[model samples]
Target: MIGMGSSRTQRPHTDRRDWDNLKSVLPFLLDFRSRAIFALSCLVLSKVATVGVPVMLKGIVDALEHKPEQVVVLPIALLLGYGLLRLLSAAFNELRDVVFARVRYRAMRRLSLRVLEHLHTQSLRFHLERKIGAISRDLERGTRSVSSLMNFMTFSIIPIMVEFLLVGIILLKEYPPIFALITFGTIAVYVWFTLRMADWRMDDRHTMNTLDSQANNQAIDSLVNYETVKYFNNEHLELARYDKTLNEWEGYAVKSQTSMSLLNFGQSAIIAVGVTIIMWVAANDVLQGQMSLGSLVMVNAFMLQLFIPLNSLGMIYRSLKYTLADMDTVFRLLDQQPEIQDLPHAPALKVAKGEIRFEQVEFGYQADRQILHGLTLTIPAGKTVAVVGQSGAGKSTLARLLYRFYDVTGGAIFIDGQDIRAVTQESLRRAIGIVPQDTVLFNETLRFNLQYGKPDATQADLEQAARMAHIAEFIAKLPDGWDTVVGERGLKLSGGEKQRVAIARAILKQPPILIFDEATSSLDSTTERAIQRTLEEVAGDHTTLIIAHRLSTIVNADQIVVLDAGRVVEQGTHPALLALKGHYAALWELQQREEQH
Candidate 1:
């Protein structure tokens, strides 16, 4: 796998960054267009009632000014109209919520699925660099923020803009043009200042999000390695580390609140000046009999409704910044190109006899540090081959390259005379099964984990695979049998038990080519002997690759290949290699001495 690029980086948003992030989600809105339109219509109707409230108040005030006899039923009518308007506003807003819930949920589901699919496409190295907690938090926060923005747009931003337009038109129609001018001008200044302040506070939002992901990663790491912490008596140290992250998050939150306080104060000050000027003019007009008393009341009510949402403009803008910061990470994850994608017209692999070959394969995880150097080897059809090498001799690289987790830098690998790169990755992987040295299980039921290999395997098939892997006896003795729950990463099971579960999974796959990467290294000698017999029986007439830790396990393999410094130093039957007294012979002798000690 190649190194990560800037496409994987989550830099903070700049101009139109929010819109750029949102573009990925535009499909959800379009898919549910009718619902979105209905919700938008509700918003408009609700605002109409909102703006109508002030007009109703003006009518009520005018009716009260009439002599009691002249306005018998008029005041009652005005009061009822005012009550209906308030109810209409509340009702329409609630209806909008109901209408848009589907769209919001669907958008979240689709976005989350895309991120998960993209993450799976990433190479193992990419995953090794990304902490599970941090990446999970990024996805969680991104999806949540995306859902929240819908509410921000419908309830806060769009409604506020609509109210502005309505209030401007009403003021121009009913009063002096200067009143409209002052109201619009004040709103414009409030929005501009709020935006500038929000942009300045974006740093705090980024810091908060970074701190949040760091804290989560620390917690996940500590908990996952709970045994290690206890063994070292580092409980206090772990707590201190977690507390430091919390303290940073607390500091950023405090700064955010303080900045919000200052912004709100400035917004209120601008609005107060605008309100005072407008009311002063209205009061003078009323005293001079140029405007009615109801007119003063109507203008005041308009100012109240307008300022209510305007006051929240700063908060909405701040939330927008936070949303962009959260989603930037998810978008960046999607932007990454898979290091080893199949060709556009790649076909499924056809494994006639599963003859595997590495012809002059050269590769490196990094450009400056090559691992495998011009290595070439072959496993004949229906034959078992053993690969033995010292650590860092590029043994594991062979398995990864065959799995197409990465493409070799030079040369090619072939199966049945067809280049592996010419085939689709999915089909190629499907034809091979591996039992790795480090077996990590999902936190699920034992039955579910076993079935993960072949979901359609019958109960009888599952039992046969388990028996062959030497795990059926242990599972049958359990209180819940196969239904027993395996804790996170199969922590409830011993290392040997987890390895057996992995063996059972691979056995269930029953692929034509099998790679046993120290498959029995974790098992006890008695169990290893029994499972080794079963493995030989299963390997009959199929290609097998074994990376052996205990040399005794591969003594009966059809052929043995010894690797040194990324090259094949020797290849022969066990007895022939023993006679040659080469690297294989020395390794066998060293292991024999260790066992004797």
Candidate 2:
């Protein structure tokens, strides 16, 4: 079995936690390396153009201060270059975004696919424990956060640093070292303060995310149970729950904004102080004829340009932190190892006789409670075996084990004298067909759901299967016929209708082994009897396991197995067991009395 465990990510991104996420994203970047490189090149070019803007303005100011008679055509050229520089900055940024679009979309697509694939492989317990609304909300947020984090780091954070470096170098060459020291020190302090404050705000952000997900989950849960809410008159209770979550979220929202206020005020104070010191030095230089007024204008312009990005420093950092938290959830889902997997070099299951045997099968979903205890049973080839049991007697569990949904905890299950664990799960499952008690159909047309069993079934095959399942007469009466839509979970159809659809689906599969897991439980006596007849025809010479509650449904079974607790107490033909007057006979008598009453 190959289990790809949790990876923090491939390469390190913003921090250590981002390593796993970025590692997963590295391949997408490498796949489009040329475009990434071109985009990066544009980033540098754009920053260069941006840094030159202040210099050109300085030149224009110097020329304006000089006599018009003494000025030459140089100032006019400088003005045009200044305009051109602004245009190039905007143009290069837009072009870079255009070039990198493919990389962004491809990365999101691959990661989303990987997440989805892994979620499908997870055990049923994992899905049962989590709400669908919350799970979907986290995944959606995580995928979107990937794009945001990348955009912020590349465009906002990285480009701003590059511009600051260029401005610092220019200021140093043009003035005394004290001016550069003041600007750099102020920036360093501003960054440190913003990071510390943003780190604290992360708790509030996390709380907000939790409350937001709860609110969404509650709202969706209530909506999905719309009929139940209306029947119980619980609309006020649902609204009260939803209102509570929002109110808590609102409290955190206020705290988040308040903290942001403090950060902004502190950052602005630092920048104002630095700019004032620089202006003071520049005015002294101008008075002493050591610096021109235009030089002072250029220095102030650099400060203004640099302050723009710093203003959002806390917000950007906080957003990136939250994004990584969301992505961590996705990565955690991707990292989960499926409990059951096909062994290495496992071959496809080859069914020569389709005989199924459970040898001392002991199993449970949890270790503390056992569902099946030393259960031994077998269905011979070309025969029907009925497993009759009361509620929680391991009837459904036997069906699940036969399907290999969960491996036996203490023993092995075999099909055709071959251990199921030794064969590929895909092939093992492919060789068996099951029509579960609850039939969940896609929200699609009848034709689509029918053909889902055999994707390439011919029109004649579809009609034949539908007729055999006793659903053809009903479909033909509908105006849309096969094209008629089945609502979500097939809720639009009656219970009997859904069961027939499931039976038709199984019939089309043409597997060597069939499991009818309370397949007719949802139908009325008349419809159930009709479906049972169709099932008998489909069973043919293949192995069949019928897990039924009503003894009447399995009276004709070749062999009947009576289960109590976790063990099979009796096994034989229904008549043979009745003659023996054992547990099977007693149960049969009880059912007869109930029916008479």
Candidate 3:
């Protein structure tokens, strides 16, 4: 049997943990290689044109400083060049964004799809333990973060670095060493301060995220269980729970905002000092005739150009870091390994006879709490076997194991003498149909939920299944008929209605093997008897396993298996087991007494 032991937990994201997560996003970005190349080309050309704008401005200033008669003629060409350079820079930047839009948005789409597919592949145990609201929040943040990180990296961070390099080259080549020293020094200090402050402020952001997720989870949980909340009159309790999280989040949010103001002040101060000193030196040089007025103008223009992006540096850095943290959550989700997987080179399950055998199977949701213990049973080809047991006897687990929702921990399960673990899970599942005890329908039209069983089923086939399941008439009475919307988890429908819908869906599947897990438990006695007859008709010539609570429903089964504490205590024909005066008989007597009253 396949091993049913796999465990993992999500770790908090840190700088050290985020590198791999960032690297994981590279493939998505690289998928559109031509677009990436074109976008990057635009980035380079834009910055080059941007740098030339300040140089053109310097030329305009110098040209106008010439003899008054020649000033008008000389400066016109320079002024036009300046404007052209500015326009080219803006055009190139906009073009870059237009070309890269596909890459950025498609990356988000592909990554979102990847995360969703991965979530589906995860084990039932994983999903059962997860909170839907928190997971959805992470998914939303993570997918958006892909675009955010790329935007900051491509448009904000990279452009700033390119501009800095150009400015540094100009300062070093055309001016004295001190000019380069003060400019570079100020930048280094500014970056260092921003990094340190942002790093400290990360705690605030992380706290806020945690509290936000908690608040969101609580609200969704309460809403999902709205009936329970109302029944208990606990509206204020839910509000208090949500408010507790929001209050904590607000504290961190205030701290974050206030800290941001401080960081901005510090950054501005450093830039101000650097600019003031540069202007002081430039003005002194022009007065001493060591530098022209145009040189001072060029210096001031370069500072303005450089400082604009530099001013946004802190915000960009924090946003990029936040995005990486979000992406780490998504990548960690991807890192989860499914507990159940088909063996190497596993073949499709060929259900020629559809005989199912559970041989000494031992299983549990947890190691310490065994749910099924060495239970052995069988349903022969084209026969029906009904398993009856009290709660916690592992009846539902049989369906889970057979469907490979969780692999058996010990021994093996086989169909047609072929080990289930040795075949592809998709093929194994395709050969079987099940109607679970609890039926959950999508919040969509009744037709959508019914057609889910057989997407390509004909309209006639659909109506036939619904009629057979005894739900067609009920649906026909509705104003919207098949188009009627089923609310969340089919809450709009009565329990019996939902069960009938499930039966119809399973009937439409028409698989060789069928499992009815308390399929008629929700119906009244009259509807139960009617649906039971329909089920019997549908089960003809198909291997069927019925897990039932009511003893009356399965009296006609070919064999009855009595389970107590996950062990098969007895197995025989229904009448034979009733006559045996064993556990099955005792349980039958008790249920009959309850029914009579």
Residue pairs that clash (backbone atoms under 3 angstroms), model 3: none
Q: Where is model 2 more than 4 Å wrong at Cα?
A: 1-16, 70-72
How much is 520 displaced in model 2, in angstroms? Answer: 1.0
Candidate 1, TM-score vs. the true structure?
0.96
Tens digits of per-residue lDDT, candidate 3, 1-597, equal 101232222224455467787788789887998998899889989999999988888887777785567776778887888888889999999999999999999999999999999998888988888888899999999999999988998899999999999999999999999888988998999999999999988867876776777678888888998998899898997887777668878978898999999999999999999999999999999999988888899999999999888999999999988887778778888888888877889999999999999999999899999998898998999999999989999999999999999999999999999999999999999999999999999999999999999999988999999999999999999999999999998999999999999999999999999999999999999999999999999899799999999999999999999999999999999889988999999999999999889
Q: lDDT of each model, Cα atoms only?
A: 0.88, 0.85, 0.90
Clashes of 2: 5
Candidates in order, TM-scores: namely 0.96, 0.93, 0.97
lDDT of 1 by residue, 378-410 (tens): 999989999997998888789999999889999
TM-score of 2: 0.93
Model 3 earns a TM-score of: 0.97
Compared with the true structure, what per-residue lDDT tens digits does model 2 show for residues 313-366? Answer: 667777878888778767766777887788999999999999999999999988
Worst-scoring 10-residue span by lDDT in model 2: 1-10
Best by TM-score: 3
**TM-score: the better of candidates 1 and 2:** 1
Where model 1 places Cα greater than 4 Å from the true spot, the runs are: 1-16
